[model samples]
Target: MDRQFEAGPRVAAVICAAGAGSRAGRAEPKQFREIGGEAMLTSAVRLFLDHPRVGHLNVVIGAGQRARYDAAVAGFSDPRLGAPSIGGATRQASVRAGLAALDAEAPDIVLVHDAARPFASTGLIDRAIEAALRDGGAVPAAPVTDTICVAAADGSRGETFDRAALRALQTPQAFRYADLVAAHARAEAEGRDDFTDDGALYAWAGGRVALFEGEARNIKLTTQDQFDDDLLRRAGRAFLAQGDVRTGSGFDVHAFGPGDHVMLGGVRVPHAFGLMGHSDADVALHALTDAVLGALGDGDIGAHFPPSDAAWKGADSAQFLADACRRVREAGGAVAHLDLTVIGESPKVGPHREAIRARIAEIAGVAIGRVGVKATTTESLGFAGRREGLAALASATIRLPFRDEDGL
Candidate 1:
């Protein structure tokens, strides 16, 4: 069979192996269990460490499993995979700690993966990484093949959910290192500790997240029945040389009317008149915010932050955009790149382009290089040309960190 490959940016893999795996009924943690000829965690770690693009590796092991994990990795002399560290109480905590354990020379991107999913394939990892590089953050997720029933707390079925809208999220969730670090710090400080995954914590912190199709073969070894060496090995070999990528587009506009100031990329840009709207009339920010939200299949800005509420009567536009970006990032996605074009002859985009990009970078918690800003004139043609007010258009490319067998 012909082999296929996809290129992606530098990434760090942070394996969460701190869980006890009590559900698996194993003498040792499932991550330490042998899948084929190697420990599960070791197998998973080897995947990313072997990848050429993977620049750093951090393994978060349970406090007591350090010695055993160390022994398991002793044979793999990859300097990129740093020495393991003790994980925290919860999975989120473990991820945060694992990210912290990365060497001072951390990679530009980070992929947080579940060590128990020993069957995760390199193709899935490549797809996730490609998604992240294009969209900002990425995660491996399989469609909910089984019928989904939404049950009430009283043990009664409330309603059946749309299978098309359902997905069984899986790991190797990836993100930009700096954004992930900041998000974790923010969530920790805010005392929001109820997340079941890193992506959830990221969303709560207002980061954009993107999703990639995951292979059903890459099953999490959560149950004894699901543990099969043959299946894992088969899946691994089949996807050893495959990869994928996806792209999305977003655009938003608001007419100029009245307000104190116009918000652009989460920064207040001085203007003669504020754009008219419920929230702060930041045409640029709104456009950017919608672009991100739209890409994630999340509702538009109005649906998220409604104008119906009086609280947002004159709220800051930057906050709205920041919050939206937070949702995206928390979903294991990153703002790969964003290009915004402000329309209108007044308030020249030339002088403010760099400032707008900087502000956007700050809002999305991404490097300035990943954000772009430019301006164009209507050539005195339409509404913008008439100078009735100013308008803006934005396109965003986001990336999701993906977990690959080769830690690239």
Candidate 2:
């Protein structure tokens, strides 16, 4: 409809998340890897999802990563979130792909952002928008804090560049949508895809560019160390700020049945017999799920995924745990800790304790250290001691907001 800067301009965000993250040394792309309980790319895309100014959201990802990308963002749904677009060989190509995807609506303003920079605040987005409105294109930039040098090939001392005049470019680089698309198209035609970012491409195409204040903490996740600490996100500064602490306990049991393997704690463990239930019967996960739901004042597993329903027949128990975690988030809470105990006489849990913990963390979307797994026997006292069945007990500690109606 050609809504170019119309009354209440339509804003679109192009998130470039195609990088393989070779520097981070991870097998999966850094964008899809979990960072602070969520994928880095998802964390970045969510900021614009519910924004009033952002009418459309497009994300570019690497080829053959659709399933991986979908899994990372499966928990988030918003009207502004658009379908995924496959990226090209380079970052510039990826941004252009996202912009092309955004052409259907013809938004007035476009913000080209990196999915690696999850910390880009809403205030920064506003600043970029303001600058782009004033200038033809705008990029958020911070003053070069470190002295840079143009060194020679053999480590010889060379000309030193003045740090005061240099600026470190950041993303969510805002621009007139039409102009930015044209610039990218021109670069592609001219075989000038060498530019590292859209700002450089715009400048190379003789477009006027303005620099706005950039956040010092909004660092892109390139190296492993940066993703390791993640202090800002791990600390839960954005949410989980209240003092309403709560706890809950859960227990689940399933008798041994006919199968070669059993699903326990989201991990496939080998055994002569499997657990019998409507679902895959991940006893550990079921107990943990109930623990989380109980902590949130929600119903237990049977109430949610009932055995009467055929849909839950052989259904993966991971989904149950995922749903419980989502409810915690919906209730304005986060899981602080999870303690699980596995009771059985055979098929030792010690051999797979770490793997079980890792799977639980992945399913709960929490850190591995936050999950504790232990195994014990009832000393020949009950069904577990008789090797008739296995049991799991779980405890969950969570933090939620204080509501006066709840009366603590």
Candidate 3:
């Protein structure tokens, strides 16, 4: 160790998942595909995000992968998670890209792991960080169990190699930040991109390499069968048992107030009068927010953004819906779908249905297809029929964890 290790060294986690994973034989890319009822990349990212030693996480992904990546990481809120960086053609290039993403605030240590391997435990993470501090560069490796043999070009055994000297490497490889960065730079300059892992790059750069114990069960998912196994194990967890299918409904009405436009599903539409309330009074979003709260057994919008608070005056209703979505995610659940109906005589919704759906999807962090919006009048029977006020009815379907006592 050339430099004295910091007593509290800041460690960053880098997840390399840029590969297309064609070998997995799945319709979607392996990382984005579900393993434990969640995206494989999401599970992998969460493991480190939950680790106390990791101060930051930078996930490297391929081009055009941002949308799905955002969906995978939507629920977690942590300052340690950085924006996704675009990766290059190869694994080494992708890792370099991730490292470059952290150049502005390089931590004392970095743990680079593959996204395909979702089972790296917290204990392993601690070991890697400790090993990096003590050994300069260290990788987790499992001892070889099978007999080893050197093969000839034509598939003939040339000679038997010693099994005692063999070990299979795994990720969560830890390295001193500056040393790893410099080694990668050297590899790039030398046009030596053949190294498969960072440890090899470190060794090629004439840096000392150390090995730490690795898990045999921390296997990477390379095929669909492995993915199925992952999901099976995930199902075995008590928290993942099926039961909670909650549906919540919300209704909101705002009388015609003097304004030039009104907000609906985060989109603004010209109207003779705007909805009046503590916030922008986006009736559709307010209804949807309440519906989400109802599904969560949480209180309505007023309880969250009380009208008594002056800060909420003239606030954008999208914030309320976003807050509701965040709550749902934090509770280890998701809003499966949203259906909204607009009850009004003016400011027709037909012209802006697609726009409104897209806006709601954006605010709720859900797919546009999952959002349904419709418009209908009260047939000239009540206040809505007389065009005195506008009302919205919304329903939210959410999936929540089933507790032992709350079984169906």
Q: Compare the candidates by lDDT and give the number of the best one.
A: 3
Q: Which segments of model 2 are wrong by more than 4 Å?
A: 1-6, 229-408
Candidate 2 TM-score, C-alpha based: 0.57
Tens-place lDDT per residue, model 3, 175-236, is 99999999999999999888889999999898888999888867888876666755678666
Give the runs in model 1 whose Cα sits over 4 Å from its true position.
1-9, 153-156, 227-408
Cα lDDT of candidate 3 equals 0.87
Better of 1 and 2 by TM-score: 2
Q: Using lDDT as the measure, name the better of candidate 1 and candidate 2.
A: 2
Superposed on all Cα atoms, the candidates' RMSDs to the truth, in angstroms, are 16.3, 18.5, 15.3
- Each prediction's Cα lDDT score? 0.74, 0.85, 0.87
Inter-residue clash pairs, candidate 2:
none
Evaluate residue 341 in candidate 2 and report its C-alpha lDDT on the 0 to 100 scale: 98
Descending-TM-score candidate ranking:
2, 3, 1
How do the residues 21-62 of candidate 1 rate in per-residue lDDT, one tens digit apiece? 888876678888886668888778877764545678888888
How far out, in Å, is residue 315 in model 1? 54
Give one digit per residue, the lDDT tens place, for model 2 in 1-408: 122343667788999988888888778888887766788887887777635467899999998889988887887778688998999998888988999999888988899999988877656776777777668699999988888997899998788999999989999899988898999999999998888889889988878788999989788889887666556465655465647888999999999999998888988999999899999999999999999989999889889999999999999999999899989888878888999999989679988887687677767766565789999999988999999999999999988888989865
